[model samples]
Target: SIKEKPSSKAEKEDENPGTVRILLLGAAESGKTTLLSQIRMLYKQTFTESELIHRRAYVYNHIVSSMKAILAFASANDLQLSLDNQQRAKEILSIEECLGPFTQQEYDAIENLWKDPAVQEAYKKRGNFNLNDSAK
Candidate 1:
């Protein structure tokens, strides 16, 4: 016999005409954004141009943060990057949130760090810690 899942608040809301509330909670990189995107698609929602622009900046910032996490993991585990890649890792760690999108230099730094063998090894072990999906 198959088990029936209990109905939750969302199902209860369908009986009346009112706002629906949902909360997503999970560890980092656990697909919260993916779930939200699915929900939006289910509702036939679309992002406005301004929202798209803001989301672009978000993607840039997430890339930087993901690199920082990988670099930190490499350092903590005593993995050594090449001198130039070490410099790139330092630059990525010190980067602030992107207001718009990443500049060319910033983007290159992340790409270089990501190509480092140390970073790649760290990425392989990312499941031991919280690293963003963008790092993949």
Candidate 2:
């Protein structure tokens, strides 16, 4: 007995023709993921509450890890910090403390810390570090 070839319908089903597929590609530091996230938010349904909670936790972890790396770089390089920024960094580096729901003052302090020349330089050097793509 001879076997018959699969039909086009079978091929399409294997490819999941009903599903939309998107590919993002760009340079190392480019915002491809950010653009994809924006597209998802604009075109797809909003995230469920549980998804939002999960994402919040992930964001917090990412921020904490990034801050720690910056601090380590600063320490290794003997980077100077203003008295106020030093205090702010201390608070941010406190892993035990819960983050988010920031008060206006805390928000301002964090923003200022990020804007500091040392922090800015460190941030620019982020390309030197390797972060898992999943974290982005």
Candidate 3:
């Protein structure tokens, strides 16, 4: 059996008056925008049926614009947050409110995806130390 959140839908919302921030650290082009948009669509809800659909669409656009980066946590990578997980979703948004926006690359790096060889190699190259002490 699945567990449920204690708060009602109206109890928590994007405009509830709190700040949230997410630190997305990634190399580059890791589909950060897509992930965020997907998250926004996932938690979206409205009491009425029409509101549900419209609100969901509205949520999608808002997320895309803001490009919510809270969904990139390594833990959340495997498990998606659906409408049933509204509580977590709200928390993420609330956090992002304070943290501000971050790019997909930001997410990947923050999530430690930079461990990849390519990223490591590139980083090494960028930060290479040409120690020519002996020649002196």
Candidate 4:
């Protein structure tokens, strides 16, 4: 009879000589960070205050970068936005000038701009680039 393969834990120990190593590889924005966060939650149970703070910063960065990309795409395509949305985009881009946290109203305004149909259409065009079908 053929022998069964060893358990993953046993195979890892054998390969690393007592040290287990996991390597995750993927393209950009391919859910690597999300996967790592899930794994961390499963194995570590909870995050420290500092880790939570760092995660918050990462989320904020993603939001800001996404906003910037949307604005850039709109401008490049000469896509017209409503006066309100235009003002909101300006406010979002000038957050550094205020040197303060965003108010709830400002956050709502940004979210609204992001949900605009024109913006969504523009985002769909991005599927022509490197983004995979799932990401699109």
Each candidate's TM vs. the true structure? 0.73, 0.55, 0.20, 0.64
User: Residue 61 of candidate 4: its Cα lDDT?
Assistant: 60
Model 4: how large is the Cα RMSD against the reference? 8.6
Assess candidate 3 and give its lDDT: 0.41
lDDT of each: 0.81, 0.67, 0.41, 0.70
Counted clashes in each candidate structure: 0, 0, 19, 0
Pairs of residues at least 3 apart in sequence or in different chains that clash in candidate 4: none
Per-residue accuracy of model 3 over 1-136 as CA lDDT, tens digit each:
9855548655455346673545566644455645665766786822577645664664444443232333333223343344433343344344433233445644433334233333233333332432122111
The regions of model 4 sitting more than 4 angstroms off are 1-30, 96-101, 128-136
Model 1, residue 65: displacement in angstroms? 0.9
Q: Find the 10 residues in a row with the least total lDDT in model 2.
A: 127-136
lDDT of 1: 0.81
Off by over 4 Å in 2: 1-46, 97-100, 130-136
Model 1 lDDT-worst window of ten: 10-19
Best-performing candidate as measured by lDDT: 1
Candidate 1 wrongly placed segments (more than 4 Å): 1-30
